[model samples]
Target: MLDMFRYNWQVRQDWFEWCRELPQERTGGMGSILATLFHVANGEQIWINSMQGTPVIVKEGVTSLEEAVEFTELTQSITEQFLQSWDDELAMKTLIKKRRDGSEITFTYDKIIKHLIAHEIHHIGQLSIWSREIGRKPVSSDLIFRDY
Candidate 1:
């Protein structure tokens, strides 16, 4: 489970790093490439916190992919430590979460992990389209596909 999370993080980090060489306009929608990265990283933190029934921890004004990566790493570290206390049975327990609009739903921790990875993949697809608009190759999503 943790390995899946790490693979998703590596893909996102690789995309952000690859995007750094391009002009800001290429990734400007939804702010810039850095902001989009932060959005994805922050959402990961939000969902992880929600799953744990903890208050969301937020840091504002992350202006670079480097900073966003650091924040994401920190969030992942904390979340992993939290998860360490749980066994397989506990990890599968359903979590009750509230939507911003006040609706409520339940999801298991594994389900949330699936959602987080899928959400990142969806946004990365947007980044890939943007990259192609400017005639750039999208970063490879497979971590083991490259030496890294």
Candidate 2:
């Protein structure tokens, strides 16, 4: 399961490398690839902090693909360290999330991790479509072929 997170992060890394120079307009469409990427990175950081019983600090504004990749890598590194020391009991722990609208939601540690991975994947699909629409080939999405 954690492997899946790393794999998809690598795919996004590939996307960053592949479309590093894409104009902000193309990448920042309705969903805004950069914004979505920031969401994924920040989401990782936010959730990890939540799991550890700390304040969820969302450092926003990834202005470039390079920054997005770097932020993603940093968050993933912390996440890897956190997961490395995790146990089954930790997976069952719950984290309460407070939305901007003042609503609170709680999720189990394992569920938050799964949701973060799925969230990234959902946006990656959007990035894939954008990549091909611009005549650039998107990264292969097959897990079997993924070397991450």
Candidate 3:
């Protein structure tokens, strides 16, 4: 589990760096670069909050890439802290979350961890596509590229 979290964090850091390097034209869009980063960071927070059974509030209004990077780093740090404090019993327990569309779902800590990584990968893929469409060089996303 710790390995998974570390790997996820590394990949997220790579994406954040790529976002930071995006030119102003590439970063400008419906939600813009900052907004996309906020959405990604908020998604991580939502998963953590759901697992902890805390009140989940959607975050908004991030205006700068630097702000997004700061928020992402902070949230990742908290996630790492929580994982460090996790016990076997807690990891095996299930968390129930109520969706905004009035649906309820249950997941264990292990499932949440996997979901968090997978969800980020999905979004990063989207970002890569957009970057390619805009003629910007996309960062290497394969895990092997980061293995060194």
- Comparison by TM-score, 1 against 2, better one: 2
**Clash count of each predicted structure:** 0, 0, 0
Question: Candidate 1 on 5-69: residue-level lDDT in tens?
Answer: 67777787787678677766344546776777788878888877877777898677486667777
Per-residue lDDT over 71-145 for candidate 2, one digit per residue giving the tens place of the 0 to 100 score: 888888878888887678988988787889999988898888889878888888887888788777877777798
- lDDT ranking, high to low: 2, 1, 3
Question: What lDDT score is found at residue 92 in candidate 1?
Answer: 88
What is the TM-score of each predicted model, taking all chains together?
A: 0.80, 0.84, 0.80
Computed on alpha carbons, the lDDT of every model, listed in order, comes to: 0.75, 0.77, 0.72
Task: Point to the candidate with the largest lDDT.
Answer: 2
Q: Write the per-residue lDDT of candidate 3 for residues 1-148, one digit (tens) a residue.
A: 6666676667667767887676672553336655665776788888887777666655665777777778888787767777887888988889887889999988888888778778767766777778788888766777765652
TM-score of 3: 0.80
